[model samples]
Target: MSLSYVGTQLTIYVGSAILIAGVLGNGINIFIFSSVRTYRNTPSTFYFLVGSIHNLLYLAINLTFRIVSVGSGFDLTRTSLAWCRARSFFLSTISVISFTCSCLATIDQFLATSQSAHLRRYSKIELAYRIVLVTMVVWYLQGIPWILYQNISPISTTCVRTNAIYAIYVSVYLLLVLCVIPVVVMIGFGFLTYRNIRLTIALAELRADRQLAKMTLIQVVLVIISIIPYGINNAYGLITTGMTKDANRILIESFISTIVSLITYLYYMGSFYMFLISSSRFRHAYHTLCDNTTSNSSSLLCLVDDDYFCLCDINQIAQCFLYDKTLDQCKHCLAQGQCIKGDTDTPSDYVCRCPRCHFGSICQHNTKLFSFTMESLLSPDLLSSSFIKKSVSLSMYIIVPALLLIFGTISNIFSFVTFRRPKTRLNGAGHYFFTSTIFSQLSLFCLLSKIIHIIINLRGLFVQPMVNTILCKILSFLLSSSTRICYWLIVFVNIERLYVTIYPTKRWLKEPKTAKKIIIFVIMLTYGVHIHELIQYTIVPDPKYTVHGKWCVTQFSHSLQIYNQINTMIHYLSPCLVNLICTITLLIRPARIRANLDKKKSR
Candidate 1:
């Protein structure tokens, strides 16, 4: 594979891993810090809590966008000016806030561990909270200039600093403020923390109290190790910006930078693991929490989110055993959302907290209202890819769609042949019917493609990014456009039939040439109406997969969703109304004609 392709795949696989690990680690840290009474009382753990919160924010907002943009080539910042400004603003603000918290935590660890009573007094939870608030406000204020000055440049078409001076200021800010200053603070405090540990441990009275302190010291070491390389990478980039480099050298530098960028994410994803690794008490506490033992700690109420709180028995993290019984049970939410970690109070110890538009007890229901994908309908019942493929019974999704394709292929071919005859080309309906059959057949194949797509991803098979993107966009467009156009074509047919009935005496030869042009017009109009299906759909990584794979997903903005609803009403509902009116008119018009003929005969 080419370097670009290799780089893209690396981002997809590696970036996905980082996103998952980072979110889980940071979230677990928050849960542990907030739940444990001993932890909640400490100023250093308070800063760690704040840092973890920002780490979650940073990973959710920035790393997600990076994977989507670089791995899948759907960069939202390029298209939306609002996203361009907001993304950089949050990214910078959160990075700084998290780093600041890290620095504060390191300093607090030193203060809390020291023998001096006055220094220990400085490590109050209240003071830590105030410091975090002030740091957030300061960093957020610093980031306002980014929102105002960030723009999608005409040349690069990437988010750029429109002001040269501010761009330089940002680079300097990243280098000195986030990188150099935090590293210095962490290293300095870390040294003092070690010295305090030696002095305090000699007294032999403060061992339990020093467990968190030791965890913080190790965290400080991680902070320095992760931050120093990032700082060096930035310094190198800045130093070499004006220098002309050959293609090979530039490519090598780009690869190195990518690796360094991944390393920088380690600080955010590493804290929980760092604690587990360094401190035996912390590890024991984690184990105790997982085992749900009430021996050491009482059941404490923990805030799960703003809306809900859970009583923690202190054992499993949120939804640890989403696979309580088997691998299938583990992926019971179909791997779409978090499981609320639970105890034996209920039938299951985990409740699925689904992503947006998904629901049901185990998150089995997807609110893809009016979506026609067969795979969606069968998602709740889907088994492991291996089990489904190896079992004798075909899935409902496969069986029903498979049968429909078989009959659909046969029927459309027969219709196409019937419409092909010169005698059938008497009016517009014949032409419309002919084209409808073509899209009908196309739609069936698209259905077949969808089934294959689901199965391939079900088995966790990787497709190249560019090819996958194209398939995702094209398959969705064809299926949606064909569905819409088929409905409208039926409406058009009824309208044509009504026209012929009303003015049958005015005999003008309806040539196929005119019919052909009209068909082209209708086709163009149909595609134009549903064009957003192509623009809005994209391939995103599927966490359900054991190996690297993607799911073809569509997301519409609020305005677009509104437009789509209106659009669906127009394409889907309008045809039914038009056809209903046409059918009624054709029936009534013939009876009225018969009545007039009877009156003439009596005369």
Candidate 2:
């Protein structure tokens, strides 16, 4: 047989096995995470639960479609534009939502282990729900663009991007959003969370936190590994598109693409196994679920409250021996190996007891077989020192922000007052500085509100209404707009200074009226550019603290990439480039002047 045929056959068999195993595992994960009270209540578990559900859907839809298409040359998605769009939309939505939940889970852990009590308190079950809801809405909307862009070819039964540019844009976007951003955030937050857990004071909480962190970290590492090949393939395609194609290049690209597809399948299949291997709690829950299914317990109550007799008590020797002597009572006991003839107090009465690690009257429940000990892994002094370090970290959280807020507020106020004076305002460059100081003051005010919020949250007295939508939107706008305006204002001031240095004869450039006009233009231009923020940013309710009120956040996903690119250009890159050019020009002008003077002297 040809190598291609062999490889194809292997892929079909392996993919089928993965589909079955992943569906079964993820289905069980969903059941346990959703049903178990202890797991259900946890914020990280909520994220994991949502992720598992999406993963199962992804595996069912994507894997089954791939397997069928490969084996029988059947492609449902290629039958119509609507089907293609729907398939593309759902594929992107599920993948993004799954990864987003994982990212949120990582962030939730970081917040839960934060040195700040206020931040830690934010890690609640209700918050997880809100985040998941927001994520779903955002990703579903994000998939709309894909639906619009994807089409089925009329000549060939295939789905493809509408054009090469769109394809390139998507490849780069996916690389950043799916791979780069998630990997960076997970690793960065994972490091911080690990450090925080190491310094946790309570032994029980420490162990639990450590296990969860380790589980999340391992899953994140695996996800990064699986996606790296896909990212490289996307990047390679983006760079090599429209280039001269050769057979060797085509062969190499084909190999990479195949490998990428296989690894991506593994990504969808591996999460359940990762949890099983890395998490003892997950294993215990799985075992408990299995035991419950096999046991004759009609209700979970019978498993916990074993004292009460239920309909499932048919195997109970004591009940059988107590009520009826006509039946061979010891015969039932002998079958269980828990009792023999004359072993009990009497023939009619019997003693029934389960072996170790078994519970319930009939020994139907199986408890966890292994106990984990961390004392051997962690030193006693380290545990004691963690308590002291935590107290110090908490104090720093309060003190550092407070000092910065107080000093920054005072400095900005003084700068604003000094620059607003008529003597300073008349100077062209001073006007720009004055406007910049005003923005600086506004920015400081926003910072002050944040610090105050933190303090109030620390005291457990903060109300949610204080962070309502209007406040959140206004604060976000002010922070972003003010920061951008400050950057541009500084750039304008530097350019104005360079203008006067290079062209002293241009008197109009030094006029306060000219400076005033430029300032007005800068304000209008920045406000126009950032107007979308006013619409996109709004107050979202904290699911856990609805009574207290909501916090501000941006909604929608379609325009965010474009919006961010514009902001980066206007706020950061453009200003830096302008300032650099002006500085170089100004420096070179003085050198040119001295060089001309030397030439004149020699003449």
TM-score, cand. 1 vs. native: 0.48
> Compared with the true structure, what per-residue lDDT tens digits does model 1 show for residues 441-545?
889889878767766755657557778778778887898788778887777778677767777765342456666776787789989978998997766554433
All candidates: TM-score: 0.48, 0.48
lDDT of 2 by residue, 1-603 (tens): 644555467566777667766775687678778877878877888898999999999987787677656654446677667878888889988988888888888888888666565786687889888888988998898888888789988877689898777777678778888777877888888888887877865422222355666778877887788887778777778788789999866766675576578787776778767876677553221212322443655333222111222222323211111223323235322113243244355653454354433332222223321111111111122223477864565565457756776887788788888987889877688899888877877776775554444334333454555455455566656766787899988988887888787678886877999988999999998888777777766433322222443333344352453344435434665576567646756665676577679989999
lDDT of 2: 0.65
Which pairs, if any, clash in model 1? 289-314, 289-315, 290-315, 319-341, 322-330, 323-330
Model 2 spans > 4 angstroms off = 1-3, 163-165, 201-208, 282-358, 361-364, 367-603
- Model 1 weakest 10-residue run by lDDT: 319-328
Give per-candidate clash totals: 6, 3
